[model samples]
Target: MRVIAGTAKGRALKAVPGTNTRPTTDKVKEAIFSMIGPYFDGGLALDLFAGTGGLGIEALSRGIDRAIFIDMDRISVDIVKHNVTAANVAERAEIYRNEAGRALKALEKRGSAFSLIFLDPPYRMKEMDALMLDLAERGLVEDGAKVVVEHDADHVYPETAGAFEQLKYARYGDTAVTIYRYNPVRSEHPMEE
Candidate 1:
């Protein structure tokens, strides 16, 4: 795959070795970016289930000041680092080989907050809602932050997850993309999809 746009536009990216990790296709990646931002004015991002670090790298390329990529698989971690180096964005990124739950806790301990979060866990895993809730409880999501979740199209998601409100949903063949915005001030009602 390749960087879809921005400073690293057209830079090649390597997928994590083996079939355990599925990289987001360039089309879906472009669509996700278009939904929240075609660009950014500098902010932090977290790729919670980072496979090849594509989402986080894309965010950094598109203007995010910093990005943290987390994955439990060792091979994926190495691939992510290699991709970051190839894109010349290593200085703006932090990559770790850790599972989602533990990574969230660590981030919380560090008092970290992200303006953007990407969740693209394996299709069989269905913890997006719980994960979002954890982020909310830990205060790890900045107000107005966007959380983009990529899942199988068959997966069902609620209108709201904790402090986040569903802002948009789209299906790309077998994959679905749900975008939620953290809005703690609004009424406790979900926006209609």
Candidate 2:
């Protein structure tokens, strides 16, 4: 796989060395960025289920200030490190080997709100609503942030859930990508000026 745009554009990325991790395809990656952003000004990103760190690295290359990558597999984590280094963006990346749930909880301690979140969990793990809710409840998602969910084309997520509202959806071959905008609930009563 390779970064499709930004400063790291055309930089080749290393795979996880097996079929265990499925990296996002270049075509889909390009399409995804086109939907959310072809580039960014500056923001923090979270790649939760980060396989080879392709998505997070791409975000960094696209001008995201920094990114945190989390994956449970050791091989995938190592490959992510290699890929980030190869892309010459190791300093802007924080790689961690931990399951998504634990990683989210631990991330709460950092108090970093993510403007971009990529959820590309294994296709077998169907339920993503809980994870979305957790990010909201923990305040890990910034207001108006974008959350991208990649899954099997056969499955479809809700149009709105908790603090996230679906903004875009597209299917590519067997993969389906859904983008959600996070809008935390605002108090109905306005504060007096």
Candidate 3:
């Protein structure tokens, strides 16, 4: 895959060696970033299940202040590191070799918060629901922060998870991108409104 925009535009990125990782396709990536637009200004990003760190790297390229990439596999972690370094965005990245849930918990313990959190776990893991719940319980998402989940189009998330409100879903062939947001002061509430 390759960096699609910003400072690192057109730069090539290495992928995880095995089929264990499902890197976001260039078309879907472009669509995603286009939807999110230029709001990445100095925002903090978390890329869970970060195979080659492409999503996080894209955020960094678009001016995100920092991005934390989490992946359990050693090889994937290495590739992510290499890609980050190659993209010249290593200064704004933190690579973590840990399971997605554990990494989020650890970030919570460290009092870390992110404005944009990207979840792109393996298709069959069925971990998105629990992860989104945990993020809400731990307050990892700041007020008005956005959470974009990438999964097979058939995979459906709960209508509400704690403070997060599922805003919309976009389908790109076999992949679906679900966008969520947290609004602390919204009287409507996720479930009740």
Candidate 4:
């Protein structure tokens, strides 16, 4: 796959050497950016369950100041490193090989807050609800921060996950993309899906 836009636009990214990791398709990636942002000014980003660091790297290329990428697989981590280096954005990225829960806890301990958080865990995991709540409780997300979740098309998420409210949702083939924005104050009417 390749970066669809920004500074690293058009750069080809290498996939992790096995079927263990599913790379986001360029079409869906382009769609996601179109829906959330065609570009960004600057902000810190977190890519949990990062696979080859494509989403985080794309965010960096699109003007995110810095990004922390986390993945549990060694091969995926290596692939991410390679992709980051190839993009010449190593200085703006932190790549780590760790499980999602542990990484979230560490980020929480650091008292980190992200402007953008990408969640693309394995389809079978079904941990999005719990993870989103944990992120909210830990204050890991900035107020008005954007959280993007990618999952199997059949998987349905809540209209609101903790303080984050669903802003948009779309399906592309077998994949579904859900975008949420952190808003502690609730409105009289929740947004319709």
Clashes of 1: 0
Q: TM-score of each candidate?
A: 0.96, 0.95, 0.93, 0.95
Arrange candidates by TM-score, descending. Answer: 1, 2, 4, 3
Q: Model 2 over residues 101-135: C-alpha lDDT tens digits?
A: 89988999988799999999999888887799999
Model 1 weakest lDDT span, ten residues long: 184-193
Candidate 3, 1-193: lDDT as tens digits: 9999999999999988878888999898888888776546798999988998999999899989999999999999999999999999998899989987778779989999889999998898777867877887887888888888999999888766766778878999889998888776673553665
The predicted structure with the larger lDDT, 1 or 4, is: 1
Alpha-carbon local distance difference test for all models: 0.92, 0.91, 0.87, 0.89
For model 4, give the 10-residue run with minimal summed lDDT: 184-193
Off-target runs (Cα >4 Å) in candidate 1 are 187-193
Looking at candidate 2, the ten consecutive residues that score lowest on lDDT are: 184-193
Of 2 and 3, the candidate ahead on TM-score is 2
What TM-score would you give candidate 3 relative to the actual structure?
Answer: 0.93
Cα miss at 87, model 2 (Å)?
A: 0.6
Query: In terms of TM-score, how similar is model 4 to the real structure?
Result: 0.95
* 50 Cα displacement, candidate 4 (Å): 0.6
